[model samples]
Target: MNLPKPSLRVVFLLAVLVPLIGAFLWLALTSGPLAPVPVTLTTVEMRPVTPTLFGVGTVEARYTYRIGPTYAGRVRRVEVQVGDRVEAGQLLGEMDPVDLDDRVAAADAALRRAESGVVAAHAQVGDAQARRDFAGAQVARYEQLLLSRTASEDTAEAKRQEAQVAEAGLALAVANLESAEQDLVRVRAEREALVQQRANLRLIAPVDALVVSRDAEPGSTVVAGQSVVEVIDPSHLWIDVRFDQLGAGALRADLGARIALRSLPLDTLPGEVLRIEPRSDAVTEEFRAKIAFSTLPEPLPEPLPRLGELAEVTVALEPLEPAPALPNAALHRRDGQLGVWVLDDGGPRFAAVETGARDLEGWVQIRDGLASGDRVILHSRVPLRPGRRVEIVERIPGLPR
Candidate 1:
């Protein structure tokens, strides 16, 4: 059986009507009011929010040791060069013991002379003692002779006088020996002082450290307190961070920090707040904070981060109460109040939010006007406004379901 032919009017109507319907559908899906605006969306939810402060900082040694000479002298030799790793008591440099050596030698000679004088004084005392004994025997014999009327009285008196003279000589010798001993003591002390002064000419490292700089080279003249070599303990390194005073209220000792060394941008060093400086920078209106590494880098990377290296630091403050928080990009300023564009059945609505603490990861706490499971626009390809129709093109990963 042959099918009935369609009329020209039906054909025209079909062609025209179908095209219009197609066009309308295409417009609706692509560019019409019904079309969904491409946007990045996220759901706000309750999460532990840790307030953070971001600041530029510098890596510094907590204690810098400036090794210098104790007195003015010409540097004789330097054992270590700049950037050399040295241990405690390692010889660093030495000053010319120009006159110090001579002084020590003179003190030594003086000590020997004092010792000889003591020996001579002792010998004199011995000689006087023997003489006194002989004189005493003579006096005794003369007295016996006189008792027997065999010795003259004048001879006995002369012998007694001689004994007394010997006794006095012995006392004088003892006094001379004591004086010599004191002179020896004084000379020995002088020698010790000279030796100490000579030892001071040798510069030694006070602790295990990295030699950062060599201020005075060999043969260079340096005055007292003038740095010859600057050393710093590598293990005792810390970062000196300066945060804006306004945002540093919660900063204190022991707070955790994330540090990005300028040289190693990809690696984040874990750190803890060591101290908050009592004084703040008046010019910058910032507070200085000292942060130390939580764990030292193992096998410390070569060309170790030097002192005064620039770094970026983010300090984690106290955790705030759990609240529905959204990405910071989701929030916008509307009439001086912070609000986020919320996706509702009606469309994108301007939801005024009272925000609380914000975290380093860009999450802002929505203290009011938002709840868990509420979708907020993270980013938009087109400008957004209140009551505008929009559909999320993609939901950013890691957002609440």
Candidate 2:
């Protein structure tokens, strides 16, 4: 009725194989390819989100002036250098007055000569008038003599003819005087124009400004309209920003902004949306905007923000009412569907979701297919699928704590 005792070889094989098989199963279930994926989780919450638009920008000036001569000339001297502060009408530099001084002197001389000619014409006119008066008196006297039978008719007729000639001479003299006066006026105008040209040669600042550039130096020849100095109104500085078109729907003027200059990354300056540019960048799919400092830093930052320097800008948009939302990291794309991996009593499942606006803090609005109190996978160590096994973690590796 008793069974036969097993051999030693059989016993040895049974002990070795049993432990080997158990070790294999433990490895497969724990750290092998069949193991559960580790992920962080979060619950959907109902709360208000203050959305913000972030954009990269550059420092710019609202008013820029290029100081140069109206006519082509060589630079004679430059009184101001780059970074100099200038006031309205401040002389910045001067252009070579090649022949302008000489031209002005010549015009003055012409004007004086015209005046002299006018004076001479007036003297001639006076002499003609005296001659005319003498002729008239002689004609009147001769007519009286003729009436008294003391003068002949021929003599009376000659005196009358002489009076007519004198009258013509007086008229000619008056016309010459008028011509001289007109010449004098023309010369004066020429002189005034020359003086203006001479004044223009001295480059003057058109406004109280800070000189940002010196384009031409002394002895440098430049063409008309070429810049010798470039300046900008320091108080009217702004940033030219570009934001993603997708998040710019709520962008508007007067919205509050925070600007971080590349040079001063640790400090953020207060600013506001000056304006939204009508033109958008089609190629980059971005909206252009102007952001101005609400109040400049007191005493200004050492080494002021240079024009064209890069900056990071954040514009505060209208706050959203309380709504069901979850961390944007929870959203995922699978099988051409936007969704989140929802964890439930059954298991992890893929739930397609409709999303709305997102905020700067990484929260996204859940318009549909999700509700408050629902738990979802925020970040997973690997790609997720329906019915995938997962392990909830407090924090995922390689992510911010």
Question: What RMSD does each model have against the real structure?
Answer: 5.3, 5.3
The weakest ten consecutive residues by lDDT in model 1 span: 392-401
True-vs-predicted CA distance for residue 260, candidate 2, Å: 1.7
Model 1 clash count equals 0
Q: Estimate, for each residue in 1-401, the C-alpha lDDT of model 2 and write its tens digit.
A: 99999999999999999999998988877777677888888899998888889999999999999989999999999999888889999999999999899999999899889999999999999999999999999999999999999999999999999999999999999999999999999999989999999999999999988999999989999999999999998888899999999978999999999999998899899999999999999999999999999987665554567999999999989999999999888898888999999877636889999988788788889999999998888888888877777888798779754
Best-performing candidate as measured by TM-score: 1
Q: For residues 179-296, could you state the per-residue lDDT of candidate 1 as single tens digits?
A: 9999999999989988988888888999988999999888899999999999998888889889999868989899899989999999898999999999999999999989898888
Q: Global lDDT of each model?
A: 0.87, 0.91
Clashing pairs in 2: none
Error of 2 at 102 (Å): 2.4
- All candidates: TM-score: 0.80, 0.74
User: How many steric overlaps are in each model, in order?
Assistant: 0, 0
